[model samples]
Target: MPLPSKRYVKVNVSQQFNYHTEAFNHLVKMLYPKRNTINKYDYLIDKHAFFTESQKQVISKTASSLCMLSEFYRDQDKFGNLYVTREDICNAIHILQRELDLQNRSLLLPPVLKWYAMQIQYHFGSDPFTLKQLRLQLGKSKSRVYDAVRELEHQKIVKLVGQRGHAHVFELVEHI
Candidate 1:
């Protein structure tokens, strides 16, 4: 991806209609493997005449990685969140706060450390943090993650179980 533009530029009304619709559609297909509907994303694009589908999909996927997929779909099927109970929000907040406190107890972490840790925990199942798989899920650079892992190890938060190719399989150090 190109380093994103630093500033938003003024867009003309005529320009919205002139955008490469097919190109945008292709971008959508490239960006989202599971997102079938373009309606919501299209509105964001047409309104602002800024931001690409890739950026939106990355943001969406990152959040989706945190929450269950069927959840968003379920919310959509029920039509907006007119029925979300206070209990639900409270339960969610409790979980989030607990995770935050746990993370704080473990030494300083990278920007997305907690989110990535949760992702690793979810996907790892019986196993955890194979570097190749983690790298793929990370969806970004590897050397950086290696550095983060080293820091994590120094904090005694994670340890290696084995290696696949150049990537080491990892397991969290603290156990219940």
Candidate 2:
């Protein structure tokens, strides 16, 4: 007998219904082969049959959200190269969530100080900015800006630079 042709059969997996079950069914059929029968689609689906219900759910959700046949599927770019991988997107999301958590945790400061911190990050980032310019740009009063900047300095998120007359220059500190 000749070798079996490896081909995947198109199965309609809907987002509204049991897409998780359908995907697992396909994966199961691929994992265990009949003794005398040739299973062609085995190569298409993932051979890992040791996944738990939760892991399977994660894969199914990822695949459906990404609009792919399975989580093991590799999407190609316009240049015919391997583009966005499932693991890549997951890693990016994890990183973004960590960043968000960091930002949220740093919100222990007052509301005005928090706003000032975000504004500083947006406007100057790591660069030095003058208090006069910040007050003018943010359209806030001089005393309010002064108080917020003082609170930020107290939190060690920013540090004062060289004093230019009554106006002070400051820059964001490291690791913030």
The residue pairs that clash in candidate 2, if any, are none
Task: State the weakest 10-residue window (summed lDDT) of model 2.
Answer: 35-44
Please, what's the RMSD in Å of model 2? 19.6
Candidate lDDT scores, in order, read: 0.48, 0.55
Q: Number of clashing residue pairs in every model?
A: 0, 0
lDDT of 2 by residue, 1-176 (tens): 99998698676533423455455546644553321112222222244444344544444333333333332455555543333344533433332222222333343455666778889888889988888888888999988888888877866688998777877889988433
Rate residue 175 of model 1 by lDDT. 34
**RMSD of every prediction:** 16.6, 19.6
Error of 1 at 55 (Å): 44
lDDT of 1 by residue, 1-176 (tens): 78977687787643542343334445544654554321233333234333345434433333333233234533433333222233333333233332223334342344566555556566664466666676787775787677766766655567778877776788876532
Candidate topping lDDT: 2
